[model samples]
Target: MTQQDVVSTGSTTEGRAPKGKALAATERIQAPVGGPGRGPMGGGMVGQKAMTFGPSARRLVAQMRPDRGKAVAVVVLGVISVALMSVGPRILGQATDLVFSGLFSRTIPAGVTQEQAVEGLRRQGDGNLADMLASMDHVVPGQGVDFDAVRNVLLVVLAIYAGAALLGWLQGFVLNTVVQNTVYRMREEVEAKINRLPLGYFDRSPRGELLSRVTNDIDNVSQTLQQTMSQLMTSLMTVVAVLAMMIWISPLLALIALVSVPISLLVTRAIMKRSQGMFVAQWRRTGRLNAHIEETFSGHSLVKVFGRQHEVEETFAEENDELYRVSFGAQFVSGLIMPSMMFVGNLNYVVIAVVGGLRVASGSLSLGEVQAFIQYTRQFTQPLTTVASMMNLLQSGVASAERVFELLDAEEEPVDAPATSAPAVRRGEVAFEDVAFRYDEDQPLIDDLSLVARPGQTVAIVGPTGAGKTTLVNLVMRFYDVDAGRITLDGVDITAMPRSALRGQIGMVLQDTWLFEGTIRDNIAYGRPDATEEQVLEAARATFVDRFVHSLPDGYDTVIDEEGSNLSAGERQLVTIARAFLTDPALLILDEATSSVDTRTELLLQHAMAALRTDRTSFVIAHRLSTIRDADLILVMEHGAIVEQGTHDQLLHAEGTYARLYNAQFAQAVA
Candidate 1:
């Protein structure tokens, strides 16, 4: 079930956003389709099953060329060391054979040269340690372990152990760094990409879902790499080493052990084919449930006002129910992988034991050889099962990789056309010429339109609800570039100006205010990080926000909770205004600046707007038109077109659309 974490998010946090809007970095990406090795960035980002110690295990191994020349040499030496370890077991086997043959027969095998024959004889005689080991010591317990052979084997084994240890350590060190750094880089890049996306992109996407992709999905990737990589690699190596040992010991026994391998793999493949999609569905459902709860809680005031608790709870329950079904199935299927492989592993072990026992009874193999063969069989079953489980993990990584790819594959905003050179505001003039735009083509919010606001003047736009006033403001900001005609700044077409450069000169106080987790001074100084203390206080003072802020024990350093929930609505707006004031842009947009405030706060904010607009070009969207009587230009917008434009006195005399709106609004207030 999608449990509600209704932890106290009191209205004391009203002045700010909830915890964090910066997307989570360590996200758990579910696998989608077509395997996990690719992202939209390209076809091969990383391997999903990189954990398996097989050939693919090397993919997880950092191919990082070490910075130090000595480290490189050491690393290479370590690999050679692990390869040499196999010789110790072979030597022991040969010594066993030599001892047995000496006790039973005197003659050496045909393969022995004259010098080798002498070494074998010494080993049989058990003379001095050196003489006995040196003889067949090179062969079996040959001549025995004298100082020389003992030292050599010890050195060789030490080197092999060192090499394996080095490989193990370096693999861990580099992989951790790479995964962590990659996540950090991805978070930064994703943030930048999200900023460039059109506002319309946010219309359909849930805030929580996007957050989870950046946070939970990437975390899943990191965790998988950390815990699984080593086990997977070791298991794979064991499988390969044991299989080779099995063949060398007895090809027939090796052949008998391998009969179930294909069956286990086929079953794994079939289960994966079914489970991959279910895993992805489970994650998707979780995102939906999270989004629903977030929206319901974030906007709880509206929900309760409308008595939507039952409706929202019912919706959440249904989504949670679906998620439960999907999760149970996905997890149930995931749980099957290891167990199924173990079952096959057991069968392989039983067969090998039965067949090898019969072969030994026939006198085809030595006691020691049979002992080693049975040891190899145990190695086969365990590592084979390990390899099988690795296969499952690898497949999961592939699935997760696919999901990560899907997220990375999400369409980023297209590059702006090459019209921008360097956008500068000399006179700070803006013009919209026959602009048309839409989030969806079939439902254009802004139709063919034209307007202009000269430098050093206030342009107030008034309209009934759903009349596209805010859409017009969005056009001026080039949030969604015009589908037709063009917009310009100071006679230069804005299409030729970099969006960042264009936006750098504009200050805004939006209806929806959000503040990061920081002190009040930091929040006000957000738009100007390097702003001096005096400057921040000045901005606050202009908005009259400092009056109440100073009342707190910490004064300007008072910390605010997310979304400024610790403050009143008016306080949030003033802080936002203070942030905009610090920008000191040539152009200003006050969108519903006073909509959520009480009368006293509205008057205070109105004074702040006037202060901030002294010598700048400005646009204000007025809900209460009475506040705009002093506007230099009054534009009455209807369906994205300006139907009336003039001063308050001129429009009143004209008795047009502006006059009708004025009468209706004034009459409503009187009633």
Candidate 2:
């Protein structure tokens, strides 16, 4: 066929124009199956429900097991700090007692002894003052406020507080290190897990949702740990230390303060139970919203071309509103914890004050002790309030943790056979033996399929969409393993070899051209990172990428944007072709490799591909029959079964599936 015979209109061999209504449907971003509004799950069931709080919280803590030593240090330093701080209130009480005694004792006439002043007060019928003096310790009669002793006691109190502050800072520093290290390890695990997962996982999951798990969720976990871990530990410790001080000062008042513990706990537990599910919902909706945005932006041009901006905006608003609803519910429910705990704490405070004041007046406890007990009450109540308030952070963090953990727990690709290696000699022969496979068990696809492509043979596969065309290539690449039978490379089972080793021998250029953000040279050399400049240039020239590179301002050094929008479709396709060519693989797979280029560029790419196929087994899937007319063998597939197989002329003569397809394209071309 002449070039003119193959170049009539922008249409595929499937008898459809490239920019027809079918393209519009294919271009619009469809939501994933389990995406927003479908159910409680997000990212293909990454979050099935709000995981049980206990287990999720425990698992999060388990991640920090490796940092146990640092955690222990944090605990120890916290205890020491709380201990030093606890002593400050008692010392302050001592200073207060000293000043009070000296002032009252000085009110007694000068040179009067302490017993005489007290006896005189009692004789004057001032029994209340006498009782207060009796309750006070270390009071010297006729001594004015001893500024020297008070100064000494205040100095001691300041030093204790200063030391406690220093230790607290150190504890926080150590705790920060632990939290950061734990989060770092978790991020590394998530990164590694992504590589271990099978292709099917990604096929079902939305990209934006998965990204939220890897990025936003993990970040939330880190922030939660940073905010809560230290505070929780210190708060609990303060409660204990303060409780002990309270009991030492007055058991009755201590019992009154203890009344709030159960009430605070009950309030926190109830609020947490209600908000846990909301937090999970909040993050799940967040992932869904993110997926929607990512898909819309990725297909922004398609959306605009089809004038679907309003539709995209509507979908985004719906998901955004859903996210806002869940977020508000989670926050509002968790926010109730603080006020409820505070109310209980304040009630306990009133009771403690009433009981302690009466006890002080009854001469059962010193004024100084009452002062210390009140301070202890505040310390105790404050920590309880803190722990309760942090329920918000705790719930949010654990919810995010569950999402990330779900990803970590996803099914991974089967491990390769132990001690396996690729076949020797790299003969480039591939064979499928009655392979049976299906994405869904109930929906059979590619059943009992068998075929072989000998070394150096160019096998072209033509099939309609959903005809298992891509599945065949995927099986060959071991992206998904066959459910039955086996595929072999050079007479050895491909599964017996490691995926990396098997893939290293095969080079593929798909229908979509992917170019990362890098220079033209870098994109071309992506398949062979160690390729020398000379080798890269040779590949570029062979694939005709040099044709356009020379015209650019930076030649091969011109950078491609993230979307590769800087280059035209044809240019990007040529760069990808060059990328595959640079690999010099033992086998090649081209899936509509020339679909994006114009007739002229497609013809040039055909020649470049012909050269690239030399001495290498090649599997070419194309919708354009003209591009594969010279293929050594052409297999016509429909519904996962090959209906015809022969050279172009033989298949045309047979007047079957291939003939009808070829005739239709010919008719269109002639018209």
Candidate 3:
């Protein structure tokens, strides 16, 4: 089968996408396939089991360690803000108590003088008896209320609230800046990490999955930071402050409120445990569904041509249904948290109100204290619910963070050795010495391979499908290092030079032509960004690319489609050849470079190739015998090894593999 067929059939496995539409880098880091938790569609959430808030989470936090000062400021501000807000209930309760005391003192049996009320309060050991009676001087006994005292207490409450508001806003502002900046830094790190990752990493990972890590996972982390950072601090502080105030008011009432804590904890833990798996499943299924949609849409033409639209739709429906089922389960389970907490909270409320009413009647507590304790009870339960919800949000965010960290922590391509040196100039001499290589350790591909090409030589490599023609070119270009042995340029090991320096001297044109969305000139000059217009035009003319450019309305300035869909296959190939020509490298590797063009265009390209090959080492990988008939050296490869090496005519006379291949093509042409 052709490589395209292999890719299409094997796409169910990870790392493969539809033809002509490889997933971008952002999509490759999504959840893994069939991992720990099973989504409705049987897919696994990406990074669900990779790491939690353990060491990996600590490392994620360490990313923000640089902003530790701002973080500390936010914490300090939050604590003060919550503390000030918590005092509002108590202060308001004190106002209620004052009003009640003044009204009680006024009702003093209607015949008692103000002196008797004051003396009675003093006898009862009231700490503020003098102040209370002085404030009541304008009030008639049993007829007037102390409005001045109420007003003063209310003013104090107002000041406390205003202070809390100001601090809360300041805290929010600083925390937002901290979270956004941290996310920004993480994105930059991810981008840098992508560059350092070896090509083999991409080969084994799906582009969609990686894209998820860069975009989706990172965004999740950012969102969680934005949402939970302030809430976590506030909730925790509120809970502590409310509990302390409740205890200060009356320890018996505080104990009554505390009964709900264990119940709430048990309910929250149960629900969280069940919903955690569903959450993982939901995200995994979401990734799978997205991948399916991407693949189907990208290959819509193939589906219609092969009349598989029904099958494709059925597959989509299956995945969609699974996603819906798991999503519903996740939402349903998590949804139960609020109502359950409310039930526990209400139960606590009932107990506090009943016991507090008895205490008030028995004179151990006042009405205002009971009211304040009820408010504290409500405040306490609220934080519990807020914390539960935040935990869920944090868990998902942590999962996504783990995935992003995984990508960042991936093994990078080996750096150039300290002693490595770049050559002053390239001489175009190439040699492969006793090379043994494999994509997998157990399945050897290239074995004991050796060859040499002197300066200015054209070496043709011809092989059948799956015979390692492309692999050989990849090794020469240093896309993959040899497992054993060494490739040398000018008698110096290529590995001794930096990868960029090694690849800088070589240019490659592959069978699959890629063109970005830009003007035709831009694509042609991509390999040599600094090329002059004259140089670009010269290369274009040599590759016969000018033939089509002149016909277009925009000439060389025409904007190509993202995939160069506006240009014919042969036209795109010619443009890539021109791009390679403009690079003007000492070594050129062309793999099936002319396979797309017609015979006439091939003839034109041959003229260009012949001129371009002067004083340069060229490796031409092709199946067409006619193009390479005059090559100085012809290497016949079969099953990853060079089975025959000779001139084309010499091989034809020997009647070996190359002879049979050339004869068959010749006979077919004559027919």
Candidate with best TM-score:
2
Identify the leading candidate in terms of lDDT: 2
Ranking by lDDT: 2, 3, 1
TM-score of each: 0.78, 0.93, 0.87
State the TM-score for model 2: 0.93
- For each candidate in the order shown, give its overall lDDT on alpha carbons: 0.64, 0.82, 0.76
Full-model lDDT, candidate 1:
0.64
Q: Give lDDT: candidate 3, residue 93.
A: 84
Model 2 over residues 470-576: C-alpha lDDT tens digits? 67887888777888999999998988887777787888877777677889998887777799999999999988898999899899999888568888888887887
lDDT by residue for model 1 (1-671), tens: 00011101111111111111122233223322343211111111111221122332233233223323443543444334334433335444544554544443234454555455555556676434223223232343123224454556456656655666666666557555655665566566566666654544443356566665666665665666656655555556666666787788889988888887888779877777677667666656766666666667667877788787788778778989998998788777866877998888778778877876666545466545766676666666676566556554555454444445445545544565675555453677888888877644566566778888999889998887757777676666665567798888888787677666677777777776777789998888877778898998889998888889978879888899877878899888888888888878888887777888899888888898899888999998887878899999999887667888989899999999888888988896798
The residue-by-residue lDDT of candidate 3 on 146-252, one tens digit each, is: 78878998999999999999999999999999999999999999998887766556554544456777887789899989999888889999999999999999998
> Where does candidate 2 have its weakest 10-residue lDDT segment?
16-25
Clash totals in order: 47, 0, 20
Residue 457 of candidate 1: its Cα lDDT?
89
